[model samples]
Target: MQTCALAEELAADNDFILYAASLHPFARADDQELSEKERYEMIMQELQIIGRRFISQGLHVHVGMPDGETAIKVCNLIQAFLPIFLSLSCSSPFYEGKDTGLLSYRTKLFEVLPLAGLFEYMENWNHFVDQIEDLRKYGIIGGIRDLWWDTRPNPQFGTVEIRVCDLPVKFTSILALVALIQSTAAWLVEDVEGSSALSPYLLKANKWQAARHGLEGRFVDPTAILGDHPMQFRLAAMILKSRVSPYASKLGCDSYLEHLDSIISGGTGADHMCRIYQNTGDFHQVVRAIQKEFWQ
Candidate 1:
């Protein structure tokens, strides 16, 4: 909270205020600001037509693992739940001052990059390392960071980075997501034997559903026999609460986990922004409402 407050204060000092949505709803074509780094410059050049649109924010949660093998295992196991995280953190419904007709348009934008979106399933640590090495050897990427997968094994940090979530508007919602991700990772480490690797196609479809409809999307669980029928994503998330509760409690993040219920009942940040726009019929008013709600 102090970090956020300090950032707000610094921005205010410069006669500017922070807007916490994943995409800048009012950005223009000429708003493609480039960084000093060569890597970012190269990315901007490659993006060309979609350079400005590529500017979006996301929340990346890194959970430490014992080794690269464990990180890969958790990344594989957690693929099935990435969409749930995206659904909870959908805050990019508007883009370039227009309603985008998608809950998290940011997700779609990021996937436009060459090596972005869901990664191919890895068999183990060696499989992951070999792929990275090949990508570098072929000059396809400069480093592992170039593979912008939704979830990846960060060998440098000994962590599994979950990068699918939008930057949720409220700080508490951010904490809730962190608690959920950490607890889920802990649970995966303990019960990984019971979890199976989901098909990449199924994972991609589920992720697309989440990006389109947020909580209202349908999720197909291949693991369940009779329950293989599609169900609302919200219900699927609620069902997961029980499985992760013991881990959350053990992690002493039960209070934060409880906040997930508030998010589910109240709606995601995207839902809130959409409602505001619907009521006011003005994008400016939508942004003002978001700023007000964010500081509360």
Candidate 2:
């Protein structure tokens, strides 16, 4: 069976269970497929372990927009929501038998690169495309490499891809996330004018808070930058439950509340990590526990 098909049809049905898998050599479409690199081969064993644990790890979301411009608009509008998803979906809080304290530390590790984030708004597709062209022309950056944003445009598929969450151990999490992405795109296509514009700083601030607090964070209203008050997962949950539940339900994710309610009550992946730490007081033990619970 195709790996992707297995992920959707089989792995997710039983408690959102996703079999872990290793990550082997990563190749680009423009590059050679087979290589004799020594170091890459040396690490293949560990990579295979990762492969078995994650099964096939990726955040594959399909946006509803027809063009890159709309993708950009929707991406910018929903950038603020990315951290909320991250907080909720993070599962790899323990790594290599360690209590990292950081929820989804695996996901955050990608941010070490300059391009790993949702950046400042592009005025439009013209500007967006033009910037890439200029970067390529000047040799400053390659043409549209996977800049790991919380969300990014998949130009080839004409869909915006959001890479905020960690590898969901359960397939249902992936389905719920995809459903949320689809409904969000649908909402944007129909209600672009209804969204209030937020400055870049406030957006980043909210993301920082969500990363720290997970579902417990006090999210700033994107429209109310100067407002002293803060929003909570309670509000985010309400929006997601109302806007995303129906669509998520259709994708064999009828258990959408199972995922949402997990965060609502248990907090988020980060919250779970904290609980684990409090119990064992060891990072390595946490990672070991996670590896057992998630992979076995």
Candidate 3:
């Protein structure tokens, strides 16, 4: 909250307020603002497609793990829950001054970059290291930071970084997401046998559904024995089955996890923005509403 207050004060000094939406609702795509950092310069020079679209933000939660192996295990175990997290935090419903008809349009924009989106399965720490080594050897990427996967094992931080969520509008929403992610990580660590072996195809499909429809999306079950007739469920239902409350209680974040129930019942950030636009019929009003509600 102090950081946000500082930012708000700074922006106020400059005659601008802090706008916390994932994507700029009205900025033109070609209006570029390049950073002076070498890596950012390389991104603009090499990947010419990334312009203002790359300016979008996300809420990345890093949960600490005991070892590299445990980080990899947690990354794999947490893959199935990424879509649910995205749905809960959807905030980029408008892009280029227009309603995009998708909850988290920022997800689609980020996926346009190379090495982005869902990560490939790794058998172990050794396998992950080998893959990164090969990518570096072939000049495919300069380092680990280049691999912008939805979830990755950050060896330097000894943490599993979940990069799937849009920047939610409310500060409490951010806290709730962090609590949920931390609780889920703890649960996964305690119950190694509960790891999900969901197919990569199913994971991608679920992510797409979440980006398109938020909590209203349907999730496909990978365990159905019927090969061509798998059962599907509402994303909210799948989220309830995750059973993270027990871990949250142990971690002393049970109250934060309870906010998830409020999010499910009230709607995501994107849903809130869309409603404001629908009522006012103006993108300006939508953005003003976001700015007003951000610190609430």
What's the residue-level lDDT of 1 in candidate 1?
Answer: 86
> How well is each residue in 162-254 modelled by candidate 2, as lDDT tens digits?
767665544455555566666655655665553444667767776666655566667775644224467685567556567655555554454
TM-score of each: 0.95, 0.70, 0.92
User: Residues 35-64, candidate 1, lDDT per residue (tens digit)?
Assistant: 799877887788787775677889999999
Output the worst ten-in-a-row residue range by lDDT, candidate 2.
20-29
Total backbone clashes of candidate 1, pairs 3 or more residues apart or in separate chains: 0
Q: Rank the candidates by lDDT, best first.
A: 1, 3, 2
Q: Number of the top candidate by TM-score?
A: 1
Candidate with better TM-score, 1 vs 3: 1
Alpha-carbon lDDT, every model: 0.85, 0.57, 0.82
Which scores higher on TM-score, 2 or 3? Answer: 3
Q: Pairing residues by index, what is the TM-score of model 3?
A: 0.92
> Considering only N, C-alpha and C atoms within 3 Å, which residue pairs clash in candidate 3?
none
Using lDDT as the measure, name the better of candidate 2 and candidate 3: 3
Worst 10 residues of 1 by lDDT: 220-229
Model 3 residue 214 CA deviation in Å: 0.6
